[model samples]
Structures are given as structure tokens and as C-alpha cells.
Target: MTVHLFLGPTLAAAEAAAVLDAVILPPAAHGDVYRAAQRGATVIGIVDGYFEVMPAVWHKEILWAMREGVHVLGSASMGALRAVELAPFGMEGVGAVFEAYQRAELADDDEVAVAHAPAAYGYRPLSVAMVNIRATLAAAEERGVIRPATRVAMLRIAKQLFYPDRSYPRLLSEASATGLDAGELSALKDFLPEGQIDQKRADALAMLRVIEARLSAGLAPKQVRYHFEATIFWDSLRQDAAPLAEPGEGSWMQSALLDEARLHPVAYPLARKGALTRLLSRALSDEHTPRPLDDETDAAILSFRRARGLLHAEAMEGWLRANGLGAEEFARLMESEAQVAAVQRWAAPHISSHVVDQLRLDDLYVRLWARAREKQRLLEEAGLADPDLAAAPLSREELLAWYAERRGEGAAPRDLSEAALQAGFRDEPMFVRALLREYHYVRLCEPRER
Candidate 1:
């Protein structure tokens, strides 16, 4: 009787492992639940799962699993949300969180959402979940630590902030700033350290106990009444979810294509570095989302089309056909592209802060610094700190040609601002100004250094 549990910051793996006889996995992403069911898991319990960073666990996957005779249960955090949604379909829910969702008292996903460190840190929570804060406030009110009005004001302030930025200290500070009953705020702050309620933890533990009780009572495989339709969308999701397992290993996976890329002498390093930035950007972008997920996805699609010269409908359709990509698949791809663009836009300026550190690490700092200092000295001595390439005896084409040739780049960009971002410059103006200096430095000071 094999069981699998999807858990994360809501409860420690060690604590869940001690109580339940199940394979404890990290937070459930889009394909995780489906993959577990395919692996012949008898029962699956979800305590916590990814809320924003990656594709979420799908409702259809859970329904399909139940139809396939796998008992699926959810409570606390993402589990609670899913349980309220899929309860009519036979998935059992436990604890106050699930009940709250079921009762329609909570609708927003952020109520249970929290920012947390990576798994290496035991998925330690970095921010407070709204449900916990609400519970804590209620407890404070009951104990006469704060008045009812204060609780309302405090919750409003907490809700005003982004989910990731939410914390007890920040909430109290905001209350203080807004001048909402100083004495009550002070009393609530004092009450919070000891009296703070971790509703997510409590709900998660209740779910584990329920799972234990059901198992002790001998759980029969779920016999769902609803017929699960395997649509083309479902088929595509299944294909994407399939693990790239090697021969004789039923579950362990690593892609052969990725291995080939890693083996490439020239491409490997560049690919690895790009992948690292993309991963970081995706994580950051997930939270910010740049207005809304749909809008972000559309914006990414626009950028992608611009890059590939696929802005025209005819050209886009042709490319889509060539790639054998349907509308659904294209939309999914754009979702990921959105994350990349969002990160790039926000980090363009701040990312350069590490330019010196990066150069030092690569052992190129001294050479670059010496060249920069020499350039500064020469330009200043010439009484031309900001050398204007246009004013120089050089045509527009000549300047672009020189810069392009020196940089080993392709044709000059039509939209220099976009190119600037790709090159890690703040904007086209900055890139153009940098080029002006370099062009003059090479032309006036040194003939050329090969």
C-alpha cells in the first residue's frame, strides 16, 4: 500500500515522515500529482504545494487520478484550495483551512500562500500567510489583547501589502505609521510573539491525522462516479509530464538531449549560465507577474514575435505550423516566456551591480579596470570627457560598423533599446554613449589592439 505526500513549508518533511508511512515529495507542481498517480501511488496527501513560482497542480489531474482508483486528499495551503474545489468529486478534505474554503469564507489563494526559502533550508517560511495572521488577530481579540476595530484595521493593512512582503513586524509597523490606536497596536505586537497562530501548520497536521485514521481504517481505492475525458489538452499535458527515465530505472530521470548539450564544449557554459539566469528570473517573475498572468504572457508573446520577426499573422501561423504547435501549447510556452521578460525588465539596472564582482571572479577585473582608467585619462586630457561619435569625422554607418565589427555582433539593431537589454545595458542611450567612448578611444588613442 504505497502512499505519496506533497509537502513543503507548511510542515517539515521530517515531522510528516514520522507520522505518515508515505514517500514525502516536495511541493506539487503542474505534473507532479499526475506523475505520482502514474507511478502507482495508492493514496496521495497534499499539505503544501507551489502557489506561484511554477505551473500549479491541475484539477483535471486529480480527477483523473481518482477515476484511476488512487485516493487523493488535500488540506492546508494549496491542498485546502484544491479540496474545496474538488470536494464534490470525492476528494476528502481535513482541518479548518479546507473548511474555510469549502464554506466560501476564503477565495483568494494568497490567504494560505507564503514566501519560503528553498528545500535545502527545510522550506523555511520567509513571510506570513494571511490565514495565520487572521487567526492570530482573532486570538488576540478574544484574549482582550486588542479591540475588534484594531483587528479589522490590522488585517486591512496586512492585505494591502503584497503576499511575499507580508510579515508580523511589517504589519505592526504599517499600523504604527497609519496611527491606528497606538496602544492596541503595541498590545497586539506583544501578543503576537507567543500567541501567534500558525493556521497552515495546524491545518496540515489535522490532514495528516485524518490520513492516518483513514489508512488505519483500511482505505479502499477511490471509485469516482464522474467520467474523466482524456482530451487533446490532457494528452499533451501527459506527454510533457512524462519523465525521461533511463533503461532499467522506472522513475529516475535525466534528459538525453540535456546531457548532449552539457557535453558540448562551446555551448555548455553559455547554456548553463543562461539557464541559471532564466531560473532566477522565473522565480522572481512568478511573484510580481507584471500586472496579471494573462497580460504578462501576452507581453512575452509580443517580445518573442518581435525577436523572431514573427509579428505578422501569416508569418506567425507559418512558424506555428512548422513547429507543430497548437494554440494551447503556444499559450503555455508564452507563460514561461513572460517570466523571463518580467525578470529581465526589473533586474536590468540592479543586475549590473555585480558586474565588478563577476569580472573579479573571472580574473578579468584588472585588465578591464586598467583599460577603463587609461580611456578616462586619455579622454579627459583631450578635453572630451564625453566624446560624441556623431560629431567625430565618422558617419552613422561608419560608427555602427566599427562597433559591430569590434563586438563581433550581427547587423545593428533596429530597436536599440531591446538590444540594450539583451546586452545588459540600461537603455539604447547608455549603449550608444558607451560605443561613442570606445569608438573614439580606439580611433584616437590606439590604432587597434588585436
Candidate 2:
């Protein structure tokens, strides 16, 4: 199994390589685990990660990877935090720091957070973490270098200091100024030369050893007990990771599309909004095109193959190769095409070219959306006087009557079924459910506005 280790500060790349000869990456940021999983790494060991500099790795992405059958292990820094959070889902947590987190001995993230040098410096530690300070103080107490009370005082001082400003000299100086006995401070300073503990480094090394042992043992991928949900967040990550359209056009990705929208606001903002509306419609299962039968899909595929000179199995394989699609994916594409055809057939009659042209000329979408918002605001303001009226449910008969009263108006549909269709409500229950909501709003507004 190929092992990918993300490490920094707690362990250098070269040092980590000696312990486990894997593809070593810098500290993980958001989406790194998802990318690693996409690249087909069988095992992922996360020892360090950035938190404050940017968005931390999302837990959903890790859960998605585990669902994809990748064995993930964590320890030391950010890894320890993530491991404990996801431990019930089969993420392995190694080292004392991880155990501390699991046992609830360590709570604050600042306990493991520290400032470090850049990648050029192999992520050399520039500040001490609270965990390391706690470990050293515990060791000092064991050896009688400092009394238990003095150690507690020193630890409190260290913990209170910001992560970037934490160091032994600063910690000891603070202890002296804050009522810790001078003799105890002196003893701590004396013991520091040999008693200081690099607990983060130790935990990081332990994680590496754990990963190395697993590699040597030829371990199989761990089975997760829970089923992974492909939530909206996880699906977005998958979409963001798709290969670019061409060599120089940048990635054909959702993030890139958002960037383009931001860069050229006038050109893409409305387009992005439309795309999102459609996507949300799909998510709600309100805009699903009809799917053809297996025989129909097969016929469509065969027809396309013949038209493209891919009549033989070998020729079809070559076409699939050129298109970078596996056989299964190609089959799915044919099925999708059939669904699209059904959608076009179903929509062609409803799509009036004259209406579309007039709407565009009038900038109807912007004006209509704004007017709708205004009406909603006015209705809500009026309803605020009687909260019980707002909470009251409207019956189906009331909804139909309200629709009949507002027939052919901007807010209500000329035909009730057409109204449901335009609203992207697939079922009658949902359509009535929505109309009941609108009925209350219209009824509340009529008294005040009229």
C-alpha cells in the first residue's frame, strides 16, 4: 500500500522519510486529504496541518476519503484533533497527544499549536507548544526540580501566553513576575537544559513509526463502521478536483468558475446565479429529466458508435480511451444523453421564444426578484403584529382560492399545474405545501397593502 504522510514542524521531511519511505507532503490544508484520496493513496498519515493561516482541513473531506476505502491515521498536531473527532468512524489516533485528546486531557487547540519556520527551513519550531511545556513541567515535578504548585503556576503562565510568544525563557520570566517563588524559578531554569521535553516531536515520531509498522505488516484497509454521506460539501470537493478542460485554460472547476465570476463580475455573475439555481433544483430532485429504458440507452450508444466509426468493440475502446472515459462511464454518458433528450422533449413546448426575448429586453429576472422580495418584506412586517396569524397553516382550499384570486398576476400562476412546474416542485404534495405558505403571505399582505 502506498502511504502518503503530511508532516511539518513536528517532524522534518527527511527525518520522516527515514522512518517511512512514503510520499511526504507539507502540513495539510483544506482539501489536501480529498486530493490524496483522489490520487489513489491507500494509506494517509497526517501529523501536522495549518489552522490559523487559512481554513483547516474539513472533517467531511476526511470522512469522504474513509468512505472511499482509504485508511487514514492521525497524531501529533492538527492530526490529533481530527483523529479524536473522527475516531468513531475508524480513523486511527497514535501517540500521547492523540491519547490526551481522546481522553479529554487536552481541550484547547492552542495546546498543540506553535509557530514554525518556512518550508525552506524544514519547518523548524520557532515557538513552544503548550503540550510540550506541560510535558517538560511534569518531568520537572517528577525530578523535584520544581514543586507541584510551582509547576502548576508555570504551566498556567505558559498556557496563558499566545502560541506565537510561547518559549521557555518567556515562560520562566513570566513565572517570576507573577508570584512564583524565585528559588523554584531558578531550579526550573537549571533543570531546563536537560529536562525540556519535545513532546510534539515525540508524538509526531510515534505516528510515523505507527505508519511504518502498518506498512511493514501489509495491513488491509480498515473498514469504517458508519456509512459516509455524500453531502453538498463533499460533492463540491469532488467537482472541484476534476481535471482541467485543456492545458492552459486553468482547471475546469467550480472554484475556478467562482474566481472567474469575481474577476469579471459583469460577465459571469448572472450566469453563475443561473447555474446555482439549476444545481439547487437538481439537488431537491425537482428537475430530474426522464431516464430512458436500458434498451433505449443501448440503441443510442450503438447509433453513436456507428456514426463515429466505432462499430467494433476495439474501435469503441479506442474512442473511450481518447475521451478519457472508462467503459462504465461511457455507458453512463449514453444514459445521461437519453435523459437530456427526454428533458428537451418535455420542455420544448413550454419554452416560448417570444416570452424569453421580452423578458431579456425588460431585464425581467432582476426586477421580478426584487419586487418579490419587497412584497415578502411588506407581508412579514404586517404579520409581525399578530405572530399567531403568521404561524397559522393555510388549508389546500384556501391555497386554490388564493391562486384563483391572483390568477395571471406576477406572483401567482395562470394555471395551477404550470405554477407548480415553474416553481420546480416535482410532486403535488410539495406544490400544495409551498402554495399554503404563499397563501398566508398573500392573505396577510392584502389587508395592509390594499
Candidate 3:
């Protein structure tokens, strides 16, 4: 139930701390929110974030955090920008800055962008944010400190400068060029101390108060309707941001495990292809490996654990720990499986077009071709050419038992329907049909006795 807040020049640490009991951190950048979410922050408040000279906080990561059940809220500066864009997706936006952005009154990001000093210097403001300038000028005019035309001239001057070069001194230094009322200009300058409104700061503080109140009232995790797609990029980020994902007590990384696998000739190529599928899917940038429907992912996960005899919670935990994988990583593996299955299902009909070519390349053409020819001849002679399982006149259990016996396996599972789907059949009926064919074919091949 801890809350993590990213704060910077928008609001000083002391001011934010007074209103909210939060683990305050520096302004956010790419991956910061993700790291916070992974660190178990139930609530995250973003006030200021770096956008230049460093990668900006990503929308995808923020969306990912919310999906992970962290209540992510934003306001002021970069937070306002992100909150406005992500509002429809359940990111809570607070304060006047958020409201202005939501209403479309503020369009350019520079309206809140400011040049600030380093963290050691408390992220001291080196330039004025345009939003503050606008707020200040309007306030000045309201109090008769300046005329209406003076406000317009000042706003235009401020807007013309780049964000880093914007400051009160620079704005006033160029005021003589506009040929406006000298008296009004001087009064506006004097009034800026009292009349200037720091909108970004105000909004940041307001957001802190909102978080405090929500915490007192018992906050809930953010809920999302959309499923988060775990592309390879996401996997990379997760690995990079993890708290040193080690294999056992050996301090071994996953790559070390992969290297060990690569040393084994038989496992290398298969492992390589599995890794390659993940990479190839990512390469198709426009079509990120699509996330399967929730039910599909859940079913795939269940099937995977069942196949590995890891259905129990304790067994599953042990397996994940042995592999240096967490719950999220396991789910990601299931996602990849689902994606591959989905693609294979779509391409199933076109598979026969190149089946022989593949078989030939693998040096299985001669034996397979011969077996197919003989089987067809024998089936035609026996009048079993279009063998249909529905009319096979055998019970489901009899067919399953007969097939399992021939395969030298134990009794068939109780949930044969699930097993069917896992084996790529459309349903239990189709699986039964295939089993019946294999059963009769095997018996026919048995040498006639006595």
C-alpha cells in the first residue's frame, strides 16, 4: 500500500512532503514508473519528469504500471501532459494544469516546460514556464497593474523564446522593441513579484493533497479493461529493470543458463529458434506479437503447467524460482506460446502447399512418401478409404484406451477436451476422430495370427 511520488522543480520536496506521506523520488524518465511498479508501489504520483537530454517517460510503461494494479496519478509539468493523454485509459489527472490540457486550452508542451538546474541544486528553476507567465500576466491585468494590450504583448514575447531561454529578465529586456506604454511595462515588471502565479507549482501541490486524501480514504488499485501486450521490448525492459534476476544462489544470470543450453548441441538449435521467434515477432514493429484473448492466455498457461506436472502452487513456485522467472515472466512465456499458436492456426490451411518441400529438406521424404503410398493402397483395398471416426462404431473410452495402449502411455486424462485443444485439434470430437483412425490403422498393420 505504499505510494511513490516523482517530484522535481514543479514542487519542492519539503512542500510535497508536508501534504503527502510518500516515498519521493527525482523527476521520472523512461522506465522509472516501471521500476517503481516492480518495487511494489501500490500508488504512483508523477508530478515532474524529464523530457529532454534524457528519454521521456513512456506512455506504454505508464499503461503497463496501471495494468499491474498500481493506481497511477499525474499532474503539473510532464505529469500533466501524460495524464491528459492517458486519461481515457484510467490514469488519474489532477489540478488546473491537467484541466487546461484536458480542455485543449493548452496545446504546446512548452507551456509547462522549464529549464532547471541539477538534482544537487534541488532542481532549481533556471527559466520561467510559459504557463506561469500566462497566469501571471492575466493576474497583473486583472489588478490594474497592466492594460489588456500589455498582457498580449508580454505573452507574445514569452512565446517567441525557446523554453530554455525564457525568463523574466529576457522578456523585459526586449519589451522596448514592442513600443508599448513604458509606464505600464515598468508596473507589470514590479507587479510580477506579487502578481506572478506559479501554476505548475500550485498544481503539483494540489496533486499531493489529492493523493493524501485518497490514501486516508482507502485507495484501490487501478482497473483496466485492456490487456497489456508483452512484446519483446517489454521483456527487455523487464529484464533490465529487475532487481538482479539471478538463477539460484549462484548469482547466475538467465543468459548464463542460455549459454549452458547452447553448449548442448541437441538443445541449442531448438532454443535458438525459440529465442528467434521472440525476436522476429518484435521485428515486425507494426504488428507486435498480438496478445491473445484473456481466456486464451489463461488456458495456455494452464496447459503449459499441466504438461510440466506443475499444476500445484508450490510446484509452480519452485519451477519459476529454479528458472529465475517471476509470475510476470511466466505469463510472458504463455503470451508467446499463445501468439505462436494463433499464427499457426491462421496458417494451418496453407501448410500442405509446402509440406513435401519441408519433408524433403529434412530428408524424411522417401520414407514418408513410401508409407503414405502403401497406406493408401491398403486402405482402398480394405474399403476404408475415407475413414470416418463418427461411424467407427467404437465408444470414446474404447478408442482412447486403444490409442493409449498402442502408444505405451497411461490412462487418458479425464479432461480429454482440453488435451484435444492442446494437441491442436478443433475440439474433442476431432481429436477422437484422429485417435480412431490411428487405432484401426495400427491394428490392421499387426501381423495376422492363427
Candidate 4:
């Protein structure tokens, strides 16, 4: 079977003897790992502590291999480092590295341990290599990399390195006596950064690659693409803003539309029509008659409503006034026209007959108008003055804490609950959660729980 190996610049000579059909070196010589795989070479990588130092780029490479179903192996130097990282990517292989100075290995002219010597850290020279081998085997069996086994193995190795017990410490100390120093041992921190295990960049990139692979393998494009876009947008926004709680799921725009629909269906349609007409008019002229609303237009309106708070009663009233209807004229028109019958006929094709019968269109319109007016008044009152009442821009941390608080206390606004969160935010929880987890100052948990 064809395989890809990633080798460190230092271990090129030793890895050259491997039985693979071809080899590719790291600090990528010419084309990237993807191009190497395309050329039918089994890619091998060797490096020192790649997991700790170059995780973003390294993880991307692993994801490319896993996505393309390319087999991978590494050893010695960075090979050992990569082996540990590859556990989560479902790569497998066997290799060795120099023992620490304190280990029981004979010293060489280079001051590194002999190839066959036991590692100073109480594990064999191939400990990291063995981890990769097992990971690969497990992935092969499962027919997918980044499986539960990979996650578990990666986590296990991370925990061992970061939270070693007495025996491990003693073993490491002995290994250090041979040659390994605090610097080398400390490199283990690459497995877990900043004490947070779940938010590793490798894991995030791996998950993204897995999802992309699944999508390419015949998953529905519409759903997959939508989710991908949403994830990217949320991540971008999180990066741009300081950590703060995210607004509820539908986004301000979406919630605004739903609120408008619930409060004033007839008024909503009119306001929507007026908004479109005005937008078009700005592009053309006041005398221009906009084209009839189409499905695309409806969808755009809905999307805009979700993204921004639009279609409130006050806004609708302003729209109506601009369209030549005064408050008194609007009231007269409602009172005189057969609004219920007109709405029922208009909604017949789109909604159930039973629903049309159940709904009192006239009453809904009146109630919605009143509520919209009230909201408009509130907005007016808060305008440029009521700082606390206004919706302030949140930092990334605040957004995450807000999300966590909602998650923990089950107090998320109706519009921003789990289902809505998934729909609106998609895969952005990690980035959002990172900010919350990193800054304890951002109070995401409910006060009572804290």
C-alpha cells in the first residue's frame, strides 16, 4: 500500500532506509504534502517537537493526509514528536529518538543517545513512535482517522505529559541524568497548551477536515456548505471581537423578522414591500416601480430580518407614511377593507387552509402594530443616551461566557437556545468557548452557580 511520511531534516538519513515506495521531507522542499501524495509518494515527516511549535501548519498537513486517505509514518527526532500528535489523526508507525542524558544509553560523538538505547524518560526510545503505530492501526480498523480512539489516545498522551505522576516523574528524572534536560522535557507541554485540553487547534482543524471529507464523500452540499460558511463567519467574528456572549441564535436580524411576523403579519408584508421599494428607488429613482417580489427576494428579506432587527411596528409605520398612508388613513383602510379575507386568500397557497381559518388576521395586525409602536418608543427613549439598555458590542470572552451561561443555567433566550445556536453558529463553539475558558474575568456562568 502507498504511504506518506513526514520526516524531520535531522532524521533524513535514518528514515531513508524505510521500505516505503517513496519519501517526502519536511520544511516541505518543493510542492506541499498534498502535491507529494498526488505524485504517488508515501509522505514521511521528521522534525523536533512539531506538535508544540508548529501545530497549526502541522495539523493542516495531517488533515490533508487523512482527507486523502494517505498512509503516514515517522520516526526519530521530530518523528517522535509527530507520532504523539498523529495519534488523534489516526496515523501509525514505529520509530526512535535519542534518550535523555540521564537515561541508560551509551553516548555518541554528537552527545545524543545511541539509536537502540532506552529513552531516559523510562519509556523506550520508540514510546512516541509506538503511540503513532497504535493510532494508525486503530484508524485503519475503523476506516477513518480522528475517531474516538485517536481522541482518547491523544488525550491520554497529553495528560501523561502535562500531569505525570510520581513514577513518571522519577522515570523522567532518571532519563534526564543521561542527557535530556528540562528544556527537552518541557517540550512535552506542546501536547497541551495553556492548561486547556479541549480547545487544541489541532483538534479544531482535524474536526473541520473530517467534516469537509465527509462532505466531499457525498454528504448534502447545501447543508455542509451552509454549516462551513457559518463556522468560518463565527470564527472570524470571534477573532475580530473581544470575548463576549453571542446574541441569541437567530441573530438580531432574524429575531426581528420573527417578532414582526408574530406581531403584525399584514403590516410586515407592507413594511417589507416598502423597504424593498425604497432600496430600489435609491438605486434608480422615486418614479421607478420595483419588480414584483420573487422567492429570492423573500429569502433575502428573511435573512436580513434575522441578521438585523428589522420590520418593527415603528419602522412599518414610517414605511407606510412614506408610501402615502398617514396614521388616520391607515386606520381607515384597516377598518374599511376586507383585510381578513384578503390575507386568507393571499396565504392560501403558502399555508394550510386550517391555519388561515384559525388565524384572525385583522386582530393580529392591530396587536402587532401596537407592540411595534411600543418597541419603537423604547428604541427612541434609549437612543444615544441609555448606554446600559442599548445592545453593546461584546468581546469574544463575553460572548463565550454568555453562551456558557446560557448553556449551564438553561437561561438562553428563546431565540438563542441550543437548536438556534447550532443553526446560526454551527462549528464556532470551540473558538467561542476558548475565549470563555481563557478569561475567567468574563462571567459566563450564572451568578447563582458561581
State TM-scores per candidate.
0.57, 0.54, 0.54, 0.21
Q: Residue-wise lDDT of candidate 1 within 1-450, one digit each (tens)? A: 788999887999999888888899988878889999999898999888764435688899999999999998898888888888899999888888899888889899889877554444466676789999999999999999998998999999999887756889889888998998888888888888899999988888888888889889998888988988999989988998999543342232346556777899978899889889778777787685553365455445655765676543335545665665655567666666667766787877677759779999999999999999998888888766787755777766677677777878665554465667778887777887788888777766665553
| Candidate 4 global TM-score | 0.21
lDDT of 4 by residue, 30-72 (tens): 1245455556543334332222112212444544554555544
| CA lDDT, candidate 4, residue 325 | 49
Where model 2 places Cα greater than 4 Å from the true spot, the runs are 241-450
RMSD of 4: 25.3
Q: Candidate 2 at 6: error in angstroms?
A: 0.9
| lDDT accuracy of residue 412 in candidate 3 | 58
Ranking by lDDT: 1, 3, 2, 4
User: Comparing 2 and 4 by TM-score, which wins?
Assistant: 2
Alpha-carbon runs more than 4 Å astray in model 3:
243-450
Q: Candidate 2: which pairs clash? A: none
Candidate 4 lDDT for residue 76: 43
What local distance difference test score does each model get?
A: 0.79, 0.73, 0.77, 0.36
